[model samples]
Target: MQHAIHPAYGPVVFRDKAADFAFLTRSTLGSDRTVEWEDGRTYPVVDVEISSASHPFHTGTARVLDAAGRVERFEWRYGREAA
Candidate 1:
């Protein structure tokens, strides 16, 4: 490890807007936005689109894509000769 060359790593807040969830963790990424955490301390807040709280895979809400149906629909729509 080199001195004065590595990005500072400290506590940060990662917020998932969609799930309205937030958690505190260590990160090198800093932000100007700040938020008061449960411990009554302010930390840099980062807004994220998805996290374990709202992720389909983590929440077991993932849906299987209907690829066969999509292919059939596409064929029916474009594969028809000008009849």
Candidate 2:
């Protein structure tokens, strides 16, 4: 691997604020923010909108999509006759 071209991969933290969850892992990403881990080490922290901890699929709280309603909406938007 080229030293200059390759990104610096190291330990980082991904935080889900909504669920108050966080985890440390290694990644190429970096952040100005930092947090102290349970292991008594500081790591770059990245705030995420969603993660497996708070994801609907992982938590089994996913909502069923209204497929028929979406079709109707599309038809109405395009002025197409609904069969």
- Residue 34 of model 1 has an lDDT of 98
Error of 1 at 24 (Å): 0.3
For residues 1-83, could you state the per-residue lDDT of candidate 1 as single tens digits?
A: 77999999999999999999999999999999999999999999999999999999999999999999999999998895666
Where is model 2 more than 4 Å wrong at Cα?
66-83
TM value for model 1 = 0.76
Residue-by-residue lDDT tens digits, candidate 2, 1-83: 55699889999999999999999899999999899999998999999999998999999999999999999999788888557
Pairs that collide in candidate 1 are: none
lDDT of 2 at 76: 85
Provide the clashing-pair count of each candidate structure.
0, 0
